[model samples]
Target chain A: MAPKTAPSSGTSNSFQSLLKSYIETTSSRLKLIDVFLLFLMLSGIIQFAYCILVTNFPFNAFLAGFGSCVGQFVLTASLRSQVNPANRAEFKDVSPERAFADFALGSIVLHFFVYNFLG
Target chain B: MNLVLRLSSALLAAAVVHAASLSIQNPQFKITAPDASQLRSESLSLAEKPEALSLGPSDVLKLTFQVVESEERKGVQPHQTFLRFYDEATGEEGVQPVRVTPGGKAKFELNMARPPTSLPPTTSDPLKVSLILGSSTHSPVQYELFDLYVPASQPPPAHPDEVAFAPRPEITHTFRPEQRIPAKAVSAFFALFVFWPWIVLLGFWFEIGPRVPHLFSPHILPFTASLAAFEILLFWYWVDLHLGQILLYGGILAVPTALAGKQALAKTSEWRLGRK
Candidate 1:
């Protein structure tokens, strides 16, 4: 195994190929969804860090912010998976439109709970 | 009726005879120092008051008197004989009973060092000394004897609970300090910092440029508008609307949204299948 190639360079090359393949194969619609997912993940990380490093004096507001990010990310991820053509065999009965409807309803309900917790 | 009136009149006459007035006689007083030397000796007059008498601390005062009927000069033992000491300025008074023998002779001694509990608390003001005599068969009589000057005494000890009746000191309440908040500048920095993700999200979305050709179609527009309305309703709830009002409005709006979403999704499903 060690004689095959330089280990660090080989690992980096594999990682680069994987990223290139993902960007080339994934659709623009899926990439748009991935961007939203990234935004939610980053927001949650920032909020959690602020609570830990700065102050969670208004703990409810922190919970609301972090929880909304997490909840929206989960709903969006499920919608993405259900709409994904590669997962067609698993979610045969779920149409992309139906998945979007579920996402919209779930997001609205999550937002209501989040805003209630905010105060 | 005539017999009853006659009997009452006779009884009234008997009562009148029995009501002869009583008096005191040979009243004399003397004060002596603790060493047995006499400080004052005087025979009290019946009509006019004598000069005010004063005694020092640790002195002893002795008084002698006899009770008798005014008409019969014979000594008579009265049922009650009292010596009253009254302070005119303070209205404080003390009554001490005097023991009398069968022969109507009474001797009273006031030892200043061992003052009786019945002695009213005294100040520099004088006490008016008097004698009161009462008997069943004779009329009662009171005689003002003389005024006495006693050394000033400390006022009586206050009751243990007396302070409860007095006004008390005002109460002060201490409260905890207000909770601290992060500095405004730091908060503003974080607020702006939090928005960086939005720029990243919009940038990625612009790069992707996902198309939605049917988003404004009649079937999908109502569904999209209703979804936006739901978001607006939730935002309104955060700003001013109560939970109950938001829920009611949400429930009412949900009917149209669900119908529109079903119609839109069904049309999209048809188009997708036809395209495939």
Candidate 2:
């Protein structure tokens, strides 16, 4: 049992190394997406921190700030889905143009509601 | 010219109507003099004639004196002779005598001057005078003698011809107790719903659900539910107590809770992928 565990452990370490290398070697587009997601996430975090620090008196402002971050995330996710080779099953017929249109529509609707909420 | 004629005609009609109404409402009168014995009794009590000599209706008298001084100066004698005003309505008598200045100038500091006790020879009917005078008989004495015509003081008109309208008073409003709870609940619910999508998308962007697996792992369901609960508690405490303090406390709790949620979600997502 110990000899079997040793081989399995070594394989697991190698697998982890391979996964790390694959992530590192990913195209610049994927890296850009990662960076964009990080930017959006951090913006949202800062907004939440602001909401916590400042009284939520201007809740509409908070909503707008937070909503923009959400908008970015949704748009990025849609971009990822449309561009990813692995996501072909879901987005086989959808073009980047169509994805962008969906993102734009969704963002418009979100911002409209957010604007109303802010007031 | 036509407009001017119309305006003038309207004004004339209004004046005529007013005059007719005034004549129709003319006041009636009565006369009754006090007993002569009562007047004598009142006069004997004081050295000079009472400063204010109150005379009633139908009261009459005769004055015959040769004034070496001018006629104007004769009437100006201080408190020498004057008619005292008496308000029957109040029964309050004048406190000062009415003096007739020699120059026919009459003044009363505190009361109306007494009318002259004499009537001119030219008049046969007895009449009373309501006169007020002041001191300094430096000029010819000139007496102002007029009949006392005390009309019955009519009470204020029952209804004024012109009514003055006043603005109605404003009604104060107060909120009911039962309504407060639902209002607060609705507000909290709305606040959560409005911000829900934003927070969710923010979570996705941060990769919070993928990074922290232990605290928020297993599912995003519990974290979402916990947040909802926290929001409810926060709103309730805020509504029930000092909002500032509640918010301060909420902020303190939010920091750790948010971090925990992020870590849990991240760890959970990572673990799932790792397992796959």
Candidate 3:
């Protein structure tokens, strides 16, 4: 078990290579979604930190600020997976047009709620 | 004649149900102590029908609510808690918002501008106070999802002219809860934050949920950590709602978070800008 680096490191390196390939091959749209998701998640963190420091004096405001980002991330992820022609095979019954429409509808509804709750 | 009677009865039943659901109890009202330093009466008191309240311009009014016990009311996260003061006689109204925090009670202090002279002497209606609950007014939409298992005895609602609909109210505002915030708005936030990815998992179960391991994902883990940290900080604030101490403590947390945020952004920029 000791001398040969056959078991643990071999699989780990292969996994890394696979992930790198996956990320590299990912479309610009999907990558852009990933970046946007990253932005939203980080914004949520910033709000969270601000909340911890300043206090959530305006609870509705805090919820709206944070909730919008989280909600968008979900919507965007749905858009990404559905818009990808690759996942089309998996979701055979669903059309990408329908998926995009759902995404749009969800965003409008989520933002409407967020805007209302915003202090 | 039998069909008309059945339709009328159905309409009446629906109206009754709607009315029962919408009714609200009259609020318990009192005036706060004129002195700035005093606390309100420790034992909760509800004022009876006073012909008139002897209130000066400087006097403050107090409104109190018992925390509701029902699950529906339990987590009523207040959106904006405010007092709507209306003097019927003077026909002047004022709004003062008092934000509700996480306490087992609801209390508000409202300063009067001047005694509302417009109110009728015989009428006991003081300035009206409205407690606006959650800002979002989303009632669950009902869809006929294969309306299964209907009894054959059940009759359909009548055609348009068969049932007489009442004239709509001039102002169509839902009854806003006085104390607790409605759970409708914020609970969605909670669900979205905590369990939404699993919802995605539900659809694409083959490649998601356990397979991809979203829990440990970098994008997700940070927000979860943030929520936990924020919640702990909130708990501290709740124990003693001291703004000064909270700001001080918040400053202490912000420094490290600011640094982490900068670093995270740096890496994220690299990813976004095609560095990786």
How would you encode candidate 1's per-residue C-alpha lDDT over B165-191 as one tens digit per residue?
998878999898765688888777887
Cα deviation in Å at residue A112, candidate 1?
0.7
C-alpha RMSD of candidate 1:
8.5
Spell out the clash pairs found in candidate 3: A53-B250, B76-B181, B77-B181, B78-B181, B89-B118, B89-B119, B90-B118
Q: What DockQ would candidate 2 receive versus the native complex?
A: 0.02
Worst 10 residues of 1 chain A by lDDT: A1-10
lDDT of 3 by residue, B31-115 (tens): 5556754433333222323333444546665656533323344433344444454545545455555555554356665455443
The true-structure Cα RMSD of candidate 3 reads 38.6
Residue-level lDDT tens digits of model 1 in A1-119: 66566878789999999989999999888999999999999999988887887778688999999999999999999999999999999998988988998998899889999999988
Considering the two chains of model 3, state its CAPRI-style docking category: incorrect
Q: Best by lDDT, which number?
A: 1
Q: After superposition, how far is residue B252 of candidate 2 from its true place, in Å?
A: 48
Model 3 chain B: ten consecutive residues of lowest lDDT: B142-151
Candidate lDDT (C-alpha), each:
0.90, 0.48, 0.53
Candidate 3 per-residue C-alpha lDDT over A1-119 given as tens digits, one digit per residue, 9 for 90 to 100? 66577878888999999989976887655665666676677677767865675456568888988899889989998888887868868888765545654664476457556655763
Cα deviation at B9, candidate 1, in Å, is 25
Which candidate has the top score in DockQ? 1
TM-score pick, better of 1 and 3: 1
